[model samples]
Each structure stands twice: as structure tokens, then as C-alpha cells.
Target chain A: MKRKLTIFKIGGRVLEDEQALGAFLKAFSAWPELKLLVHGGGKKATQIADQLGFTPRMIEGRRITDEPALEVALMVYGGLYNKKIVALLQGLGVNAVGLSGADAGLILAQKRPAQTIDFGLVGDVVKIDSLRVHWFLETDLTPVFCALTHDGRGQMLNTNADTIATQLAISMSAVFPTELIFCFEKPGVLAQAQDESSVIPQLNAALYERYRQQKVITDGMIPKLDNAFDALRKGVQKVRITHFNQLKKGTHITLE
Target chain B: MKRKLTIFKIGGRVLEDEQALGAFLKAFSAWPELKLLVHGGGKKATQIADQLGFTPRMIEGRRITDEPALEVALMVYGGLYNKKIVALLQGLGVNAVGLSGADAGLILAQKRPAQTIDFGLVGDVVKIDSLRVHWFLETDLTPVFCALTHDGRGQMLNTNADTIATQLAISMSAVFPTELIFCFEKPGVLAQAQDESSVIPQLNAALYERYRQQKVITDGMIPKLDNAFDALRKGVQKVRITHFNQLKKGTHITLE
Candidate 1:
């Protein structure tokens, strides 16, 4: 049997709520296997940007990581948010270390060039240094990664947490059977929007495509599901979209 | 022969100057030995404090790390400055990993108790996890530490860079022949107040005390020298105070 590596990505909603974050930490620390945690920047970055007199600009749901916004992201995501999660996990007796992608050259990224939009310092993942991460795992430490990467040429780049989680799962799945979980407020993808109880039990590529064509899973969720299906196709054992409270029970997405 | 470990600590003057920092990084990367870098937070923290609408409070040249000040420290020291150094080192082909004391449980600290002045969120080093650091050293990775520690109970603490360097040197010297170097603008401990050419070549405990009494070395140099001698007495092979440009030629301090 292959060793299991679980990668949990907690979204902004849970990160913004103190009680929920604390509860999630408790639950997360209770697991006795090898795991990694990826956290997204919450309202803190926007608040800091507002205080710094720059209104944060977002294009379609993604942040435009301009110079000032990149600094704010570095401070909030890499400093405040990442350290907070590591400390809380420490208090829970989980030896967690915080990391930006620059640390240990864990992830090498390329600046997203001007395709249709100039995303400034935003980066797309180019390579994942799985050996060092595996070393960290073997050392009995849980790595809590912030949504940041580096361009290898002395630049820190803001990355999306969901993409990072999916990419990490794809890479680590080659070494260990990897399961990726994306946690948010909702229990899972709903059959009908705003209907809490109508959670989809399973999602596959064909059904996901059908739902997309029927406008069932729309807007922000489309990209998230696309990334998850990509992970599924890339040898990740499974990907789950669920609430923080129901991390183990959610809409499990698979190729089969 | 035991392996040689040289830990260089760069102070504010070099950090604040882009050209000097770049030059130092180039020189530092040229060295083909085991090394680590500890960086001090320069005026960046004070600028951040001012921007955040608070006058930075300092007593006897030490920052009073209250809650807001600690947040600023975390952002400046652990976030911007640490990542910048790591990225720059990475660019120079040095695999540098940035760490706060919290990372990998590197340095466990105790909150400084109320002694005369209640410095909030300030930590005194209690233990240094030399084994994990030795693991890094053996793995051929240079650890660049920021001036931040954690209480191991979910609180980040602002610490002094010189003390951190000294403590690390003392702890690691038992395993490796460790040399500690503190870098600043001046060539070394100056014989006169303003004479840059009058660099003191050697400093012993007795000479340091005599110079202090004669008012040749006063103000900020006092605590730095104190930490240096403390490291020497605690088994660090040697300690030097020098300019970044003259890292190899500096005022060597020893207990003898």
C-alpha cells in the first residue's frame, strides 16, 4: 500500500472567521498521517491595501498583484496569515513550519505574461521541487504554505491557493497516493445554489462538463472544478470540495 | 577536523543600502563553505510603524515590541526582508531558506517577563534546536534567519539579531567549529569616534572593558560586543565585527 499524503487548502471564508479557523485547526491536527496545509489570504490583505491608500483591484475574482498589492500580499499572506496558522498548529501539538515558495526553492514559477491582461507580479507554477517537500515530510514536520511563489530570479509572485493545492497534489501523487481537499463555507457543490442540503455526492469530468453546459456550477466554481479535474487526470488519487467542518465528507471528484 | 560553519549577521546599514546588500550577497555566495545569514530589520519597521499611525517606541535602543509593533516586526522582518534576502541568495545560486524561530521549531523562546520595563511580545531565547539546523547544514542549505522568535505557545516575539546570531553560534559551535561575524558600515570597532581608518584589529574582554571605560566604544556597540564575548565564552570559536565590504578583515573579539 502506498503512503497517503493529504493536502488541505483552506479558503478565505474559513480563514476570515476566527472560530472556524480554530475549529478547523483542531480537526486538522487530529489527523495522524502525513499532511500539508495551504492557506489563502483573507480580507486582511484588502484591509492593508485600503489602509495604504491603494484600492485593491481585482479582475474577475483574481487579484491584480501590482507592486503595492504584492507587498501587501507578502506581508499579509506570507507574514501574518502564514505565521498565525503555523503557531496555531504548533499550539495544537502539530510541528508545522511556514513557507513561501521561495523557501527551500519549493516551487519555481514563471511570471504570467501579458496574454489578454497584465497580471503584474502574479505567477503560474512551472515546477514543483518534490524532493525537498518529501524531505520535510520525512522529517516529521507539516509544511503550511502560503499562496506565494518565486520566479527564481529574485522575485516573489502571488499565486492562487487552489492552483497550488492541485499542482502540489499532482506532483506528490507520484511519490505518495495524494488526496487534495479544498475547504470553504459550503458543505460541497450544491445541486441548487443557496440550497444547503442539496450537496452533490460525486462529480466526474463528464458530469462536470454537463453541469457547466447547463449552467449548474457557474462562475468561480468553474475554474475550481477545472483545476480539480485536472488534478484527477494527473494521477491525484482524489480531490474533494467541502466545508471546513465536513472536510472528510464532501463532493469527491474523480475521473472514474 | 570538524567542519567549519561561518554565520554572518548583516546589520541595518548594509541592509538599507541596495548596492551594499547586493555586493555582500555576491561576495557571500562566492564563499564555498558552510554558512548561514542572519539579517536585522532596518528602518523599514519604523517606516511601517509610522505609516500604520504609530510612533515606534524604543527604550535604551531596544524596540518595545508591543502588539502593534510586533505586527510591524513580523511584516518587515519575517515577510519582506527575509524573503528578499532568500530570493537574492537564490538568484546567486545559494540555496537559502528563510526562517523565523517558529519555523521548524528552530528556536524556542520564553516571553521576556516584566523586568523594570515590561517589553510586550519580546522574547528571550530559551532553547536552540541545533540538531535540525545541523541537518540543514549537512544537507548543504544555508539558513537565513530573521530576527523573530516564537514562544511555542502561539505567539511571535521580536528578538534582537545580534543575540540571535550569538546564541546560534554558541549552540552550533558544539557540533561544528563555528565563527560568528557581525557586519555594519564601518570597517570595525573604531579607535576614534569619526576616524574610519582607525579600525581596531583585535578586541579581548579586558580591552573591550577598558575601551568602554575610556568612552572609546559607547552607545550601540556596547550590547553587540557583550553578545559577542558571551558567544566566545559559551564555546563559539570566534566573533568578529566588521564592514560588509571587509568581511574577512575585521576586529576579531575573543575572551582571551
Candidate 2:
């Protein structure tokens, strides 16, 4: 039997609140199994960008990562927020190490080619250095990753946190019985878009597809659910979508 | 015979210029032995602080690490500068891992107590986890450290990069024949601060003290030279103060 590894991908909302983030980290530190954390950029990045006088470029509701935007991401996501999380975890006696995809060549990415839209420095995940990552786990070091990747050619690229989490879960499943959890503000994938109590506890691919067709699951959540189901198909043992506070209770995703 | 390790501490000035930093990292990558890097923050921190509306508080020519200043240090030193160097080194085919003192509990420090003046969040080095650092070296992972240490109680504190390098050299000397190099903009310690060509080939405690008494060596160089001589008094095998480019040619410091 393979060892158990729990990977949590926390959204920007959880990180934005100091009290919430502190409470979440405290609970996370107490977790007994091997664990890893991947965090998304909060509004702090946008706030810092505005302070730096870099107007965020958005095209058709999609964010564009130009030179200045990338700099903001580097400072906020890779540096400020990431290191803070590591320090807090260390304070809780978790022995945490902060990382970007570029560190130890843990994740390699390709610059997203400009087709219809030019997303300046955005990158798509190309590879995960699973061997090195496994070595870190074996040595009992917990890694906290921010949403940044690097092209092998000396350029840093902004990446989506959810996709990074899914990729990591898929890769590590080969060595461990990996469980991927997506923690956000919502309790889980809600049966009714507005009802918090109407969470569909067990979500499989077929049900997710039906909900997508019925327009029950729309907007930002569609892609996240898609990523979670994809991870299940790619050999990840289990997947959960839950609120940070309700870690064990939210939606459990299965392939069947 | 113990294995050889070369440790370099690059000052803020050397990191200020983009082209110079690129060239320096290129040269550092081509180095064919076990190596590590510790870096100081350049003027970027102050610039960011200005943008963020934090008035830097300095007393007696010493900068105070108040809450705002410490925040700036975390964003600049731990995030922006450290990760950039790590990405660039990775691009150059060196397996670089970026670190702060908080990462893996590598460096433990104590918050400087309030005396005549309270330095806010500034920390003095209390210990170096040389065993963990040696594991990184043995694993073929080159560490790139920013000038931030943490108190084990979960507070990240501002630390001096030169002191970090000196302490690391002293600790690692037990397992490796360590050479400590301080890289700055100037070629080496000079006879006259104004003349670039008056580079001192070798320096010892007696000569350094004589130069100090004559007022030839004054101000900032005093503490740095004192630290170098102190490291020599400890177990560090060799110490040199030189420019990033002229790594081989520098004012070598000796105990005699």
C-alpha cells in the first residue's frame, strides 16, 4: 500500500482574511498525514498593482498578464504571501518550506502562445519534477507553493493555482495515495447556486456534466469541477471540494 | 579530507544593476564546485516602502526594522529578489532553491531587545541549522538565501546577509572546508577608497587595525571587516572580500 498524501489548494479568499487564514493554518498544522499546500493570489496583488500604477489589463473578462502585471504577481504571490504562509506554518511547528514552480525545477511550463489573445507572460504546465518532490516528502519537509511557474529559458510565468494543484495530485499519485482538496468560501458545489445548504455531497463526472448542461454550475466553478474530475481520471485516488472550515464534509468527487 | 564548499555573499549594490546581476549569476553558474549564495536587498525595498507610504525610520545611521519596514523587507528580500535569482539560476542549468531563514528552520534568530533604541523587527543571529544546510548541499541543491531570518515563535525578522554568510561558513566548516567570499561592486579592499587600482592583495588583523587607526578604513567597512576577522577567529577555513566578477582576486583576510 502506498503512503497517504493530502494536498490542499486554498483559494485567494481564505488568504485575504488574516483571522481566517491563521485559523486555517493552525488546523492544517495539526494534520497527521503528509500534506502540501498550493495557494492562489488574493486581492492584494491587484491592490499592489494599483499602488504601483500598473493598470490591470483585462480582455473579455479574462485577465492578461503583461510585464508589469507579472512583476506584481512575482512580488505578491511568489514573495509576500508565500513567505508569510511559510513563516506562520513554521511558527506552528510544521517545518514548512515555501516554493515557486521554479524552485528545484519542481514545475516546468511553456509560455502560452498568443493566439486570439496575447496573455503576455502566462504559462501552461508542461511537466512536474515528481522525483525531486517525492524526495522532499521523504525527508519530511512540507512544501507550500504559490501560483507561479517558470519557462526553462529564464522567464517566470503566471499560472492558475487550481491547475497546478490538479497536476501535482496526478503526478504524486504514482508514489502516494493522493487526495486533492479544493478549499474556498463556499461549502461545496451547491445544488442550487444560491443555497448554501443544498450542497451535492457526492459529485461524479456524469452528474457534473448534467449540472453544466442545466446551467446549475456556471461561471468560475465550471472549470474547477472539470479540473477535479480530470484529476480523478488521471489516477488521483480521491478529490474533495469544501470550505476551509469544513474540511471533511463538503463535496467528494469520484470518477464513476 | 572534507569536501570543499564555496559560499558567496553578494551585497545590495551588486544586485542593483540588472545586467551586472545577470553576468554575475552566469559566472557563478559556471563554478564547478559545491556552492551557496546569500544576497542582500538593494534599494528596491526603500523604493517600495516609499510607494507604500512608509517613512523609513533610521537612528544613528542604522535603519530600524519597524512593522512597515519589516513588511517591505519580506516582500522585497524574501519574495521579489530571492525568487528572481532562483529562476535565473535555474535557467542557467543550476538547480537553485530559494530560501529565507524561516524555511526549514535553517536559521534561528532572536528579536533585538529594546535598549537605547528599539530596532522593531530586527533580529540578531542566534543559531544556524548547519545540518539541514549540509543536507541540501549533499543533495546537489544550491541554496539562494535572502536576508530574512525568523524567530522560532513564528515571527520573521530582518537579518544582515553578511552575518548570515559568516555564521554559515563557521557552522559548515565542521563538515566541509568552507571558503567565504563577500562580493560587492569594488574589486577588493583598497589602500585609498577613491582609487580603484589600489587593491589590497592580502589583509590581516594587524594591518586592518592599523588602517582603521589611520582613518583609511572608516564607517561601514569597519563592521564588515570586523565580521570577517571574527569568522577567521572561528573555524571558517578561508575568507575573501572581492567584486562579483573578480572572485579569484580579492583582499584575502587572515588571522595572523
The candidate that wins on DockQ is 2
Per-residue C-alpha lDDT of model 1 across residues A9-29, encoded as one tens digit per residue: 998888888899999999999
Query: Candidate 1: which pairs clash?
Result: none
Taking the true A–B contacts (Cα pairs closer than 8 Å), what share appears in each candidate? 0.57, 0.70
Candidate 1 lDDT by residue in tens digits, B1-256:
6689999999877888889999999999887779999999989888877877877778876568788888888888888788888888888898899899998889889999988787889899999999999998899789999999998888888889999999999999988999999999889999897999999999999999999999999998999999999999999998999999987997999887
Task: Write the residue-wise lDDT of candidate 2 on A111-204 in tens digits.
Answer: 9999999888999999999888888888889999999999987888999999999999999999899999999999999999899999999998
Model 2, native contacts kept: 0.70
Which candidate should be chosen as best, given TM-score against the real structure? Answer: 2
Q: Number of backbone collisions per candidate, in order?
A: 0, 1
Q: For residues B1-256, what per-residue lDDT tens digits would candidate 2 score against the true structure?
A: 5579999999888788989899899999998889999999989999989988889999987789988798788888987888889889999999999999999889999999999988889889999888899999999899999999999887899999998998888888887988999999998899999998998889999999899999998887888898898888888889999999988888999988
| CA-based DockQ, model 1 | 0.71
- Cα lDDT of all candidates, in order? 0.89, 0.91
